[model samples]
Target: MADNTAINIENIYKKYNALLEGHFLLSSGNHTKFYLQSAKVLEYPQIAQKLALSLAALIKEHSIEVECVCSPALGGILAGYELARALGVRFIFTERVNSEMMLRRGFQVTKGEKVLICEDIITTGGSALESAQCVAQQEAKIVAFAGLANRGFCKAILPNNQKGNEGSKIQAQSPICKLPLSLPLFALANFSFDIYPADSCPLCKDSIAYKPGSRN
Candidate 1:
């Protein structure tokens, strides 16, 4: 299989009905004209493997030691597991217990164990950070973070220090990720779409708001 780059991912999304158009209520409480439904794409095993292989390649290029791959519950499960498979590392996930992410299901990380945090889509990187925090709580080291699609918040800095979306006019770090700039964020592609707060969204005025996302 060919290396799944941004264009390849975008095309796969379109083919899988994962990329959608219209007003959507994002998990971040913002509104966007487009949405990336990662589950839809991951539903196909072959496609999921391709994406994971690409991500693993990136991680290997950096020579990042990965003892385990950790992901947030619900959304990141599939991608995280697949990436773990590609990397031949253990897979664990954090789930919302009492509205807070917890490392449950008998999962445990030892002190100084290298871990990679992953997700399907990184908008504000809230979930990924939460998962990373869980890993930290276990005294584990977060080697890096990876995602399939960057929702403009996290920049895709490959091991070679190249921007994943280099030469693309649409490149900007969103106020979301909040992680230290020194931390690396690797993703296959960057899709920068317009998002607005509910109070000021133009779509809200027209009553065009419709929550088409997985989030309630």
Candidate 2:
């Protein structure tokens, strides 16, 4: 993996500016001025390879002995595959089954395997935790986690530790913590929650055009 500190996240944003958009509802359910479309980078094999190399370098810096790299289905799969390739380790993904993420199709995390969870984004950390829980169910240890961008959100929740209250408040725990490539031009904190609901929202009442955005 390449060194995250050395990789200019700002440069990444500049390269892929055409793909990003405004007024988006993130997976974390927060509306922000900036959106990171990881797919745009992943769609380009060269960019993906560069990111994977950077992530692999970070893993090496941390001295995390990961035997395999596990990622949640859909978004994290490609990045995880690239990371595993860079590290020369096996790669697997867990898909959502009835709302609960699980490994299927004969995929299994053998007991005692040192697993590292990878994800495209780190909003809310929900999917990453699901992947971690699935691996833990097989009695494997999670060596560390890696993400392309950490969006400066406080309180990232982990899997299987929802009941506990320790270390839950701390935000951003990626081995390779890269600041968002683009900074938020505007702060939405001033906006009221009623302004952004699906319907009957205050913004709607105020005639503010609703902008629909998605990850894909």
Candidate 3:
């Protein structure tokens, strides 16, 4: 497969019917008309590998040194594993234990080891940041963050933020993202959808919003 562009990424999502349109609830407690159901596309291992390989190419291009890749379960496991396979790095995941992201199953990051936090789809980056903090607590060096798709909330962290072609596609950063602004974010595509707060959600007035995400 060729290196993926935003168009290619969008096409893949559409092909798999992963790009959903409806009044949906997000893990961030926000409401959006569209949602990128990455599991649909990731269900096919071959397609997952292609996406991961393309994403790995981007990290390699930046020469980002990553000793291991950590993702927050359960949404990110497939993408994270495939990415680790492509990059030839170790892969581990953090799960919510008492609502706290923790590395269990003997998965621990070594001090000073370069780590990359990944997700299948990055919206406000809350989950990814939580996993990053878990690594940081262990004194690991977080080299970067990545996802299969960016929801355009943290466009400021995009490495090519200044490039007219790519930058223009993403809007200015919103306050929703909790990730540090200093770290770079790599994603295959940007999906900018209209998100609304619960009180202001227009969809809520007419129909009940559905929570279609993995998190509670």
Output the number of the lDDT-best candidate. Answer: 3
The local distance difference test score of model 3 is 0.85
Model 3 residue 29 CA deviation (Å) reads 0.4
Model 3 residue 51 lDDT score: 85
Better of 1 and 2 by TM-score: 1
TM per candidate comes to: 0.89, 0.71, 0.92
Clashes of 1: 0
* lDDT of candidate 1 over 1-216, digit per residue (tens): 335444366788999898998888887788898999998999989889988998888878767899999999889999999999999999999998787999997999999999999999888888888899998998999988889888776666532233443522335565666554556777877777888987789877666677765445
Model number with the top TM-score: 3
Error of 1 at 190 (Å): 0.3
- Residue-wise C-alpha lDDT for candidate 2, range 3-31, written one tens digit per residue: 44545554675587623544555554445
Superposed on all Cα atoms, the candidates' RMSDs to the truth, in angstroms, are: 3.0, 9.3, 2.7
Model 1: residue 136 alpha-carbon error in angstroms:
0.3
lDDT of each model, Cα atoms only?
Answer: 0.81, 0.62, 0.85
